[model samples]
Target: MCNQARFLAGAIFSLGLVVSGCSSVPYDGTSGMTDSNVRTSIYSTLDSTALVYTNPAAGAPADDNPWRWAGFVMHPIGVGLDYVVNRPLYSISSTFPRATGYTNEDAMLDAYRQR
Candidate 1:
């Protein structure tokens, strides 16, 4: 009836708002070192998972065994989490200078340079 129709309209409007809020823009970790795009974001996420799981860093016990398979299994889940949760959170926080933890580009660059 009328109530059902109104509920459906409200649901659709809410879905549209949620979808619009999600951004595909790749996070610029290095202040324009690379292009920002959906593809870059996906690649970076996957690459990070691969690097962490495949290369265990110096003197970390080279097992070279079954643990590596976990990375393959987790990569998709990690990517999904990044896209669904992390990216949207970053997008929202990046809008506010205080939220981003840097007042300006100079401060950000200095912090990175020191690291």
Candidate 2:
């Protein structure tokens, strides 16, 4: 059934991550994996990290919210790449709404600087 497609999709997504270096920023400030940049990287990183830690099996989904799986699955490797490729002044968390929502885009931008 359709469930298989999602599993396949998750596999493909993970494969894409590995094949494309699913790591971090480009020298020109973009995701070497896709068209993503530090902005996308941070947002995706925090977003995914939240989901996977919150729930790992979901990170390799087979349902309507499959997109939720993307960031979570990518975080482990992506975060490593983030630390390696960038300065990593500090890491923000999802503790306070004063900064922003579930995504860390605003804080990442506010605190963003190159390594």
Best by TM-score: 1
Error of 1 at 52 (Å): 22
Among residues 3 or more apart in sequence or in different chains, the pairs in candidate 2 whose N, CA or C atoms overlap within 3 Å are: 31-36, 48-71, 48-72
Taking the tens digit of each residue's C-alpha lDDT, what string does model 2 give over 35-102?
22212222354365675556454444244366657877988988798787653433443444555464
- Look at candidate 1 and give me any clashing residue pairs: none
**Cα error of candidate 2 at position 36, Å:** 34
Compared with the true structure, what per-residue lDDT tens digits does model 1 show for residues 8-85? 999999999878754566665675464432122223353556655564343243344477678878999999999999
* TM-score, candidate number 1: 0.35
Error of 2 at 30 (Å): 47
Q: 8 in model 2: Cα distance from truth in Å?
A: 63
Off by over 4 Å in 1: 1-64, 105-115
